[model samples]
Target: MADTGEQFEASASAFGYLFQFAKALHICIEQWMSGDMAWNVAVEAADDIEIHQGAGDRRLIQLKQRAEGVRMTDLSEDLWKTLRIWAEAAKADRIVLAETRLFLLTTAEIPEGSAAFYLPPRGSQHRDEERALHLLREARKASKATKGPLPKCFEAFDNLDQGDRPLQSPLMSRIEILSGTPDINEVRNALQGLAAFAVGHEAAQAFLARLEGWFYNRVIEQMQTPGGRPVTGSEFDEMLSDLQRQFRYDSLPIDPDISDMSFDPSQAVDQQFVRQLGLIGVGSERIELAVRDYVRAFTQRSRWSGENLLRAGELGKYERKLVEEWRSRFAEMAEELGPEVTEEEKKKEARRIYRWVDLEARFPIRSGCDESFVTKGSYHMLADELKVGWHPDYSARLIALLEPARTR
Candidate 1:
């Protein structure tokens, strides 16, 4: 989604920072992994960035990002272009192909069958170039469903001289693909990984500060050139806003979480999943706390946190209990409110209760953390998934909630 070129300039704007952040992470991590002190990233016509470890140890790092889940079909064209750049660099003696690494860093994971296409189906001892070319041909032949020029480019490359063939005839093992769900957590984790190798806290802080400044400059440059039309200061401001809209947690100031603890599924908004959590004999107060956390996170548009909350609703029986317990409480409260509460008011309460039972029944809570401490981006999901089936009268109220103007 981030790399889709057909988007209007406004839509593609966030990519400026998304891409730079990923590149910076790769640079720091690569430096740590390779123990290469003298390296410059995103320099001198290299793809995304170049990592020069030594004479023959130069590497090309290409960063690709997708806003949604990635598929091989989605990558073909961009992959071709990146491959071409590296292949030409190798051919021109600008870098040694064998010693250089080609890293395809993305924000989406490659699906099962797609992994084999990146290589020769896992087990073949064939050269990477031949394998890359073969996949390219087959991908093109089956390209009726795809949309791009990658297949055609690969076709032409297959016909070129061995030296000029970027992907069709070569022996290179330094190809790697790194992908993950795009979120502040991803960026934070990357920075955390780089922390181990940083010279000190000051150095790490300086690197991040520089990266932020670099992103500001890069966005300005892209805004000015922007292919079709020259950009104005206003447009650059819009880009920054768009970046904040999607990656506010990363792009804005917030305390970072650096703990190595695993993600707690209880943080999700899944009703059934929360019911499962309830199975462990969690108290009502804890569930209420979790629900508040989940609801707040969802209201804040914390996508990853919402996913976690939704996961809780996946287990059937547990969610049912949660829904029943919540509805039962509402019924008791309605009785206490007595006859002044119309049947309509009773059902309205049911709708509200049902929405909660369905969405925000679970929230992330780990040991030693305060009750009010909810992670940024922690949210609810599975709003339609009530532990108990919907009642017709109550459903109307829920529908009304969805369409506020209907009643007003």
Candidate 2:
């Protein structure tokens, strides 16, 4: 509901410090992973604030610390901004920045309302600031609660580079003790492993579902007749192959589970096809009526198969009636046209009318990600190549439709 641009700006500012904290944590984790006995991990961007530390080549170990109000989904903005700033800073601090390997360390799971940060600007800066403050406080409290005694191994490095000792001395003892153990590695490995498993399972399930849907649709297509007649076995296969060839789907493999199932007798013809036919200025309704009449004629003929004469008569009578009705309607509409209109003008007029009707009948499909309809505008231009058209006034209309009335 908020303006996306405004949301981004506000969220961006509030998460800036959090991003710095995450970077520091990542550095500590990496040192821990490398089995370093003595290492210095400090948030040394604008200030040298010690957050965490561990021993040798700790790049493999990552740490992610977040405050209470920070939502899991909302963390991405902070993460991306942190990376961007780090990259810029790294470029400037070439002498100080020695490592390229960075890992993510987190103690919190992504929370609900986390997605708020990703929303469009909605002028909610005050709210976002409040959330960020809450998260920072929570994170600090969590860190303190989980704090352990300084590892004895880091005591030696406590005196390294005395000129910078004053600022780093307080954290040295704690960093050394923590770095000596493999607790950080255990935690990081467990979280990463679980995440990888969940992602893999989800992807596999989605792939299977898509495959099943395709197979089912193909099987249904083979059993149904253009005129609703039932077909079986070899007859069905032949028809299916022909249909596939017509649709340029010859390369698709046939699945036995779906290949033999009979078509649903209750299924009606798709209205989309009917709409397409109408787009060319054809009398869709008249065509439908004619088709229905033709089917009825066939039904009656089927009842008396031996009597060809009777069937012929019935078919002829229905055909003549359809023709007569069509001619009458055509003549009446033609008479309404001005006498000055030429044959070419009428054809052009029909085309224009058909196009207008088709456009009016078309509706855009909404995307799940942004809750916006597909359109040929800026959004579509930046989206995937296969873009769909969305209503021009959809955003305004949707907002109005969802607006709650104010109480007196």
Give a tens-digit lDDT track for model 2, residues 1-408.
769999977886545444443343333334444554254433432222232233223222223444544444422433333333333333344312333323333434444343222221234342243444344324333332222222211221222324432312221111110111223344334434432342333232322233324433433453243422211223323433342332221111222232232332123133222222333345655435423322332333342233222223643453344334334534554565567876556655544433332333221111111111111111222111212112222234334533553222
For candidate 2, give the lDDT of residue 302: 41
What global local distance difference test value does model 1 have? 0.47
Best by TM-score: 1
In terms of lDDT, the poorest run of 10 residues in model 1 is 252-261
User: How many angstroms is residue 185 displaced in model 2 relative to the true structure, after the best TM-score fit?
Assistant: 15
For all candidates in order, the CA lDDT equals 0.47, 0.33
Off by over 4 Å in 1: 1-7, 10-17, 29-36, 87-95, 115-133, 144-148, 159-167, 171-174, 181-185, 192-211, 214-408
